[model samples]
Target: MITVFAEAGYEVDRHFDDGVVMLGFDIDPTRRSQAVMEAREHRAEARSMAELLTPSSVAVIGASREWGTVGHALLEHLIDGGFTGTVYAVNPEAFELHGIISHASLTEVPEQVDLAVIAVPHEQVDAVVDDCARAGVRGLLVATAGYADDGGDGLARQRALVHKARAHGMRVVGPASLGLVNTDPAVRLNASMAPGLPERGALSLFSQSAGLGVLLYASARRRAGSACPR
Candidate 1:
């Protein structure tokens, strides 16, 4: 299947058995090589999407104390989902969240951070991206909105975001993304605002709309007999 995409001139990256595929196109021949390099990083390695999917350690850049905020909810869900890896919280003003010590910034974290789930506001995303790139973080899951979806300047910002991350050989999920979940028993990473974990299975879901993603996940969970908890 990946070959099909490559044959058709699309830069296909990943095609998993569960029906998940990642593909893109490079209009410029000069940038194709760089795109391939980026694809290799996204394939799986120390600095790649593997970390985002099955990271050794994750730092929630916008971790928060407020119960209703996306940052707090994602952190709670990630911990509650039983990810067997190190979790760090980053909040400049707070020293701790959910019982773990918090750092003032991504760079402040003592050890390397493979993936960073950013839930900060749209205005501060560039600065966070800079820190993530400087820290050599592998993948980024940006749950904040106001990017390409907003059109005009927002679209330009979104384009720049990807360009910047790609230049650093880092992968980004979304500028207005909901997040990702891997129900694999060995790596149960849930870095989103979705409440309760869906039962582990073969199904892999993706959606452009967060509202619909929630609906689909909820429905899937109910069908699997592991209904989402309120």
Candidate 2:
């Protein structure tokens, strides 16, 4: 099957199995180099779309105000980082978790969510992913552990969870990631283990750990602050 986009041009890549054929696109330019560049651009665009439309976001599937809990710090990090979007915390057992409106399930969020950060139990990860998919969430950042990292059935479960996410057209970032931060809105949405927020400027840093990201931000902030000596 061939699908042509108005501005992007035609599909040139394909995969076939049984009676199903997958389609790809060709970048126009009539040159190999330009074609590759265009193809890369298309791939990037697809990625950016996935990230941007991640719908509503939450810190933990069962967050609370308890110390050392995902619930207590999730909202705090968002507020500290200045996340100005729709943020919710999911904890069915609790009426309100950490002063934020809590929902028993992602379905109760009342709005379409493109992404969710699941800190639920390992066993609950799959069900949570299923719920997110059913709720139309396209991106998932799972911070749960107890998977293959231990080297056993845990690994198998983790792999299976990833496959389940893929089947649902959802992108999973990590099974053991610290989380992420968005500098555009001056927000840090990752785990509290992060260092600290960076100074405001044209540059942004993407780090693997909240601590590291914050550290980098601090460095940048210091540098920026120092550059303008009053």
Q: Pick the candidate with the highest lDDT.
A: 1
TM-score of each: 0.76, 0.69
lDDT of 1 by residue, 177-210 (tens): 8788887778788887776667876677778777
lDDT of 1: 0.82
For this target, which candidate reaches the highest TM-score against the unseen true structure? 1
Instruction: Report backbone clashes per prediction.
Output: 0, 18
Question: Which regions of candidate 2 fall more than 4 Å away from where they truly are?
Answer: 1-38, 49-59, 186-192, 201-230
- List candidate 1 segments past 4 Å from native: 1-49, 225-230
What lDDT does the true structure give each of the candidates? 0.82, 0.64
Clashes of 1: 0
Q: For candidate 2, what is the lDDT?
A: 0.64
Residue pairs with backbone atoms closer than 3 Å in model 1 (clashes):
none
lDDT of 2 by residue, 1-230 (tens): 25334233443777898888866565555455556668888997678544743334544575666778654665567555556566777888887765667888888887777558788888788888888888877778776778767688988988898899889888876676556555444333433334344444565455655456556655665797442111
